[model samples]
Target: MDAEQQYHTVLAIAGFDGSGGAGIPADIKTISALGCYATSVLTALPVQNTLGVQALHAIPPEVVVKQLDALLTDIPPQAIKMGMVHTKAIVSALTKRLEAHTKVSLVLDPVMVSSSGHQLMEKSAIQAMITKLFPLTHILTPNLDEASLLAKMPIKTIDDMLQAGQKIKDLGCQSVLLKGGHLKGNTLTTIYFASDGQQHTYSFPKIETPNAHGTGCTLSSAIAAYLARGENELSAITKAQHYVYQALLQGKDVAIGKGKGPLNHFFDPEKTIKRKAESGKQGN
Candidate 1:
């Protein structure tokens, strides 16, 4: 193997969305876009589109376990990302597999609900996730909707975002990035709270568009890919946000479906490569 080859990897444990807007395919695209090798273990199959999810079928836990076992037996990932685990069985299976391989960072995208008023995760699965998976997560990224659900309060203001960030951090997550895209504002304020007793608030002028369906999946997966490439936690989160912001900005006018569409995760790969080189130079 060439020692200089940048082959960082992120393994995504997520569902399959045929629409390509979110889930396993989105994870693959985001990780690959950020210069990381993408791998996956599908947890569910959701019949979804830009409009809404029509149906969902969770994959059997044993099959999910077998896939993880096979993957972990061969190669290891630098980071692992969790998305759309809709069952307690899946929660338990993933937790067991992840606990066995403890070296990688885990980015948990708590996808309990969708933008279309669909309950993606079962109520029974919530406890399993909190008890088993939350402790394993290195970074938890939840949108304003999901954060409100986890924090057990309505999150509508910037102060609400900060309070919710603290509440989520107490739930065994080492760090939390409370996403503010769902909030009402011209500028989105992403709140990043770490275990280091410091907070980082990043603001981006909101892009007005309906083509932001898979932003959560893209953001978390991008962060995982950046972390896999040896970026610090906070830096990875910030860079991933920038990448997604750009992707959404460029994808706003794209008409992929009749409703809210996805981000252009592969919008500018050449530019990303150039930026990576520039950052590498700066680091040296």
Candidate 2:
């Protein structure tokens, strides 16, 4: 096949955030920045801003299924990033689609709550999500709150994190990128566990910033984008984490809205080359 014909595509199954802080916008930004084409499916329409979510409207399961099927028929994605699925019906539809399209790699961002402390998914949808989609996931990215919810226990200490990692793996995901943002300390740690039973941890010096939003969405989408580009799961996760951290560190000084603003998704030079070329051509 020609090189252009072999272009990698990433599908993002997530909600719509008009503010671009989280959901499909963040997923598309992260994937595009990481050198992949992004396709999106909106699961929820939320009234939100940088401060928080005000209300949400879940898209019907039939509509969700139709959109997914249309994408599968026309543009087959190499990897999928799932975020903010608001209902069990949506989860059921997605699982059915995944069953039909089992070849695609999946990166799951279990987005239960927004960074500004807004609940995205319903309490009832949790178990359905765990049973239906967790096993199909190639990598599950969850913050401390999400991890604790999924683990059904408090994840406060290092030992608790490890135990939760193990338990999460046993729940059927191929790997877990357990985020530690909610843990208190001078440093932040994220744990990665592969299906092969190997565990690795990445830690970063905590930067004092309240403007970090969509970090989880960005990380998971970056991982999916890299995986679509043929990187292994562990390699993809490491690079994605570094990408997100740097994006956060760079955007720490900039201001966007009243609440938590977005990270600098364009922090990588190599990743921005294609975009710059396109813009330069457009300017001509």
Candidate 3:
């Protein structure tokens, strides 16, 4: 193997959704579509579909740690994306392993609830995630509901989103991306707040569609892929937002399930990116 030629790899630690609409499946699709090699560690197995999650079976904390150890030791990822940690034990396990690799950018999608209003995380895990995982996260991507839970307030407008984003950022993450898709309006606005006193606002017309399942997973994975390819946080997030927007627009009418369908993750896939292993830089 030539050190000069390597794949830009991203690791996704998340739950397994057999529906292929969310969780590990969505992460793999999104990362691969964005031109990165995706590796995953299944944290939980959720009996779910486009409709909603029925039940969840969590992987043991020790098993999860072993998986992390195997991957982090050999195919070390350039970036990591985490979603749907269901328990405090899993959070503690992940935190212990992640402490050694602080250099790797981590994009965390705090998935607390499913699109169909099913709780995906335990209430106790919320506090653990905030105390243990937030400081290690490079960027925290939380939708309106999750943000409301984290900030302990409702987000009904862009102003509320800004306030909520700031509040979440104060909890220790380097930055927060508060998604406003749930707000009642024709337009959706997402705000990004950084600890450095920088903020970015992204607003676009909402594409009315039921095929929006796994959007949060896709968006966060895309951000990790971009980061693996060496983009800055803001650039990676901006590109990822555009990718999700296009995916939603393209898959608006395509139906895959009885309930909400999934976005076409491979609508326009890119070739796997190559980079130099020794230099830790992207290569054409």
Weakest ten-residue segment in model 3 by summed lDDT:
275-284
Query: For residues 1-284, what per-residue lDDT tens digits would candidate 1 score against the true structure?
Result: 32233456689989888889899999999988887778899999989998989998878999999998877765467799889999998898788878877678999999998889899998889988988999998999999888888899999899989898999899898999989988887998998998796999999999998999889999999999889878999899989999999999999999999988999989876322322232232211
Write one digit per residue (lDDT tens) for candidate 2, span 208-252: 887688888888899998888879888999888889989999989
For candidate 1, what is the TM-score?
0.93
Give one digit per residue, the lDDT tens place, for model 3 in 35-141. 99999999999998878889888899999999999888778899999998989999999999999999999999999998888888999999999999999999999
TM-score for each of the candidates: 0.93, 0.92, 0.97
Rank list by TM-score: 3, 1, 2
Each candidate: what lDDT?
0.87, 0.85, 0.92
Best-fitting candidate, measured by TM-score? 3
Please give the clash total of every predicted structure, in order. Answer: 0, 0, 0
lDDT-wise, the better of 1 and 2 is: 1
Residue 122, candidate 1: alpha-carbon lDDT: 89
